[model samples]
Target: MAGRQRWMTVVCVVGVGMLTTAGCDGTAEPAAAPTSAATRSVTPPVPRDLFSPRPEVVRTPQEACGGTPFRAGAVRAYTPDGPRYDGPGPHPVKLLRMESDLLGMGPELPYQWTGPRPAQLVVCEYEDETFDSRQVGTCEYLGGTVLGATARVQSARFVYRVFEARTGTLVRQFTLRGNTTPEETCPETTYAKTALYDQQVESKDLVAKIRPLVERDR
Candidate 1:
C-alpha cells in the first residue's frame, strides 16, 4: 500500500464588528443583581456537529450573475466595520439574493438602506472555503527513475458565522462538509470547486440554521 499526502486551500471573507452605543443622557446604566442559575434564562447549547452533507455551489453564469436589480430607498446591510454594498455585481449581489431568498425574506430585508432607522444590523463574521486534496498513488516512468503524482479533492468544507447587525453578537454558526464519491475524478471535474461555487446549497443550509434566531430577534 502507498502512503497518501493531503493539502488544503483556504479563502476567508470576514465581516466587521458593531460599535456600542451610549445612552441619550450619556449616563451608564447600573448593573443588575445576579440571578440564581435556576431562575436565569439558559440559552440552548449549539450542536457540536452542525454539518450538511450535500451543500450548494455556484453552477451557471446566470446564477452567478443574478440578484435583485439595484433600487433606491432600500435598507442597507450594516456591519460592525461599515455598510456592506449589495449593488449589482457578479458575486456580491448574488450572495445577497441567495441569503435573502433562503431566509424567505425576499431580496430586500437585510441589505438595503433608505434612511435613519433602528440600530438592527446583520454581520457575516466569516465565510471559509476549505478544499482538501490527497494523493492516491504515484506515477512512474518506463525507466522507473522519474516519478509523477496525481491528486484529487476528497472533500470540501464550508463554515459560515452570522452575527447581530447592530450589536455585533453572534447569532448562529454552522458547517457544511461535502465528500466526493468514488466516480468523481480530479482535473476533469474538481469536486471542491463545484461545491464551492454552488452558492444555493450553502445559502439554504445557512438559512436553515439561523432562521430560528432571526425570527426570534424579529
Candidate 2:
C-alpha cells in the first residue's frame, strides 16, 4: 500500500481481508539474536463474511497465477471500459501470505512450490488449510539480540497475486517488502528464499475460509 516503512515482515498486496488470515512453521533457526529495530509484519486476507465472488461466478483463470500456459476459465479480452482492472466473473479468493526473514538467520533452507508464478493472473490460488492460522510474519534467531544498535539495512521483496477463480482472472497483486539488520551481522533471521512453502500454506488457508461459503451456496 504505502512504500517501504521501516522494517517489514510480510505485506500481502490486499489492503486487508479477502484480504485473508495467516501463520508459519518452525524450521532450522539461526543462532543470532534480533536487533532492536522497529518492524511490522503484514496480516492475512480473506473476503468479508466468508466468501466473495461466489463459486457460481464464472470465467477463465489468470495466466500469471495459473500454473500452465493456458489458464482455466479466463479470457484474453478486457472489459468494455477497456482496461480489465477488475478480475473476471469471480470464483472467489483473497490475498494470503506468511512473513519470514530472507536474510538467512540460520542454516539455509529451501522451499517447494505447488503452483507457478508470472502466471497469467488467474492462477493465483491457495489451498493450504491445515496450517492457516499461524502468525509467523518474521523469523528471529532462536536466541539472539541486538546490542548497542548498529547502522545496517538488508531488505528483500516478496511476490504474490489475488485471482478471481470463476473466470480465473487476477483481481489484485502484491509485492512484499522486508529487511533485517542484526546487531550482529553473523546472526540474523532468515526465511524461505523459494517461498513456495509459504505460498502453498496461504492457498490452503484461503480454501479453509471458502469451505463454509462453498457448502452453503452449493
**TM-scores of the candidates in the order shown:** 0.28, 0.22
Q: Tell me the lDDT of model 2 at 40.
A: 44
Give the per-residue lDDT digits (tens) of candidate 1, residues 87-157. 22211111233232333322122232212432232423122334453433321222222333233323345
- The alpha-carbon lDDT assigned to residue 59 of candidate 2 equals 28
Model 2 agreement with the true structure over 42-140: per-residue lDDT tens digits: 566755657444343222333224433334353332111122323332222322222223332311111121122211223233222332233224323
Residue 183 in candidate 1 has what lDDT? 32
Q: What overall lDDT goes with each candidate model?
A: 0.34, 0.32
- Each candidate: RMSD: 26.0, 31.0
Candidate 2, superposed: residue stretches over 4 Å from native:
1-64, 68-92, 96-154, 179-218
Which ranges in model 1 have alpha carbons more than 4 Å from their true place?
1-154, 178-202
Clashes of each: 19, 55
After best superposition, candidate 2 residue 99: deviation in angstroms? 9.6
Best by lDDT: 1
